[model samples]
Target: MDAIYDEIRVALHAVWRRRWLALAIAWAICLAGWLVVSQIPNQYLSSARVSVQLRNVLPGQDNLMSQADQQRDIDRVRQTLLSAVNLEKVVRGTSLANTVATDRDVADRVAMLQKAIKITAQADANIFELSATIAGGGASDAANARLAREVVQKLIDIFVEANLADTRDENSQSLRFLDEQIAARQRQLQEAEAKKAEFQTRYMGSLPGTGSIEDRAGAARAQLAQVNSDLAAAQSGLAAVNGQMAGTQPSLPGTAGAAMGPARARLATIQGQLAEARGRGWTDSHPDVIALKNQLQIAQAAARGEPMAGGDGGTPNPLYLSLRSMQADRAAQVAALTQRKAQLEADLARLGDTMGAQPGVAAELASIDRDYLVLKDQYDKLLASREQVSIRAQANNQTDAVKITVIDPPTSPRTPAAPNRPLLLFGVLIAGLGGGAAGAWGLSKLQTTYPTVQRLEKASGMPVLGGVGEVVADATHIARRRQLKLFAGGAGALMGAFVLLMGIEFLQRGLVA
Candidate 1:
């Protein structure tokens, strides 16, 4: 412990001997540090908080812009608030504009603003916080403060403008795109319609039925089958009537002419019914046709056995005359059905010939019809989309989709937010003092002088039996006292300068306020 104390005492004595040099070093370092600190510009910050509200005034408008979409738009605006263009606008709108003379200067300022501006949002709210800082622009503290506030204000204006303008622009673009698509679709539809008309006129004008060749051919085949069935029924009915007439007597055994007997009347009724059934397109295999044929046979048998009473001269047999009439009607029906069948067959034959002559006609017609339908569908969809866009645009014009309220306007800062000058000044003073002390200590280490006999003995590795203290005269003591006072005054002056700088810093901040 004694040795450590001795060493500390020796170091102190060595530093004291060069106290002037140490004080000079401290003064030099302090002055340089103070100067640099004074040159450092103060930074001011301005901030604002805004709340955004998304409203849906139109019915079913949520499908167009949902809450998530609104949130995304808000987030997008927040992220782009400090973009280069916006920053340039800030620079031009604020005092920063005075410093920029050329495009390059503006660009440089924009870059700086990019770093100085910040936008943040709440996690679960629609509130956004915008802040901007201005520093070291050769402008006064008050000017910088005002610039910062102006920057934030400009950002707010841009935020609101961007939301409204972007919505309108996007809606307009969507409408234009839909219109173009609708027009293109319309042109395609028109061309398809014209092509279809030309194709029908050139290739399908003579074809029966409407639609493609295959459909017409199918319809013809179906009609031919129906005609054949009806013709067979008619032929069967005609044969039955002819047989009935052949069996019926021309006159009654006692009466020449008389009203038809009950059986003959029934038989004639059945014959008429048979003819009517055949006229209705009923085939021979139909249940009604079968039933009628059975009734007709029964009637014929009854008529054959019935005795007739009439005038002596035999009148034409009523049953035979009725059979003749039925035969004529059935024959006419048969002829009509035959003609129809022939016409249908000719149509089928013509369709077959057309298809064989032009194998691609049906395919071309089908493609034309398909294209026309597709174009029509597309045109309708585009028109609907255009209408939807137009409606949304109108709604947006009527009411704002996004509403922004300034919860906190940009504040005017009285003091700098950065470069804490007082703290920095104090720090520099302390550093200067430390550096001076370190310099003296290091200089002492390089010297061979020792303030204590023990240190001298240790360094020389020689035994010192004795040591003598220096004797000072009265005058020398007086001189030493005066020198000590001077050194104290120098150190005190350095401390006083530091205090003065701190006072000035506070006073400047007050003036700015």
Candidate 2:
């Protein structure tokens, strides 16, 4: 460790003794670098900052775009800001495309502008800053401002149109729902009314010259009453005959009284003689038989306490009924007719009331029907309009899926940021340093290492040997080391500064700080 320290000390001393040589080479390289940097063209950089203000079109609603999504949108917006279209437009509008204006100088400036447009987003920022550099051209400010404003306005217009289209679709959908619902309700009302009308007609009876079922119900009831009266009279006649038969009593020969007296006997003999005379092959309906039948009818009537009808009327069979089938059938028919009549009467009364009410209802229904026609026409027209609008929308490429504009307007530039002279000079200076270093290294490779060997041999004193000669030590390496040492003592001190400066420059890295 002590020997290594001693060698370091010796090497430092050797560098000090050759101070003029080190100083001259370093000075030459530094001057050349400075001169080369001075020859570089002046570059101007322009920058414009823009803020993105997102608008929530849904009123009173918060924006759903999260911070991450918003960041993506910002990046996307940044990309759009630096799109080829905008660049092409900028280039097309500028004099940068005309390569023959000042020929080489103008072309050089234009190429610089083309290469230098930059866009950047700050961390969690809503703003975009666009920057450009122009070499020998004037400034980069005004052109960037124009592009930002133009793009922003175009995006805004696209968004506004999209919003309008969405609103229109919403309105159209609402109208369609209303149309369907109204039509369904109308059908239901119509069906209910038709049912009511059919029931009214089926239950009602018809009458000649009668307009309603109620008008015929009264006549039906009157017919049933007359039929009932006829039935009662016929039943009474039958009852009378039955009563006469029941009251009649025959006298007996021994039990009740003595035999008939001479006058009753003689009278019976005369009646028997008369009946025998009339029964000579004569029908009961013959004149002679009819006379006898009448005499018997008169006797029967006398016994029954009934007046005789002109000696005798045609005697009917006691077991038979006039229009017999018709009696039962008419009774059933009457009952059914009466029931039907009653139902019709009720229905008719209801219908009359309904009709009276219908005067108001019918007016309303008529009005509704009339308005329905008008509404139908309007609905048809609206539907047709909607269809046409749909077609137009398709033609215009404005469909259910609309293009959304995510980009916003650009902010105004606060300052003209053109002509960044100091930054350009610094960059040029760095380039010059790099070039000088590369050149010095290449030259060192081309030159021989005889000087380095002479110094090494004089110091070590163990040289005088043959060796491979393809590779060599660097002349510029010595100059670089000396230059680094001088810079290390750059704190108001000379190149051969104090030991402290040397320790600070080299030993600090190797041994101790």
Whole-model Cα lDDT per candidate? 0.84, 0.46
lDDT of 1: 0.84
Clashing residue pairs found in predicted model 2: none
Q: Write the per-residue lDDT of candidate 2 for residues 18-44, one digit (tens) a residue.
A: 544444455455456445544443433
**Tens-digit lDDT track of model 1 for 5-93:** 87778778877888888888999999999999999889999999999988775567544554466678778877887888878888888
Error of 2 at 28 (Å): 2.5
Clash pairs of candidate 1?
255-310, 256-310, 256-311, 257-310, 257-311
Tell me the alpha-carbon RMSD of every candidate. 6.0, 22.0
Candidate of highest lDDT: 1
- Pick the TM-score winner: 1
lDDT of 2 at 358: 46
Query: What is the overall TM-score of model 1 with all chains considered together?
Result: 0.76
Q: Per-candidate TM vs. native? A: 0.76, 0.29
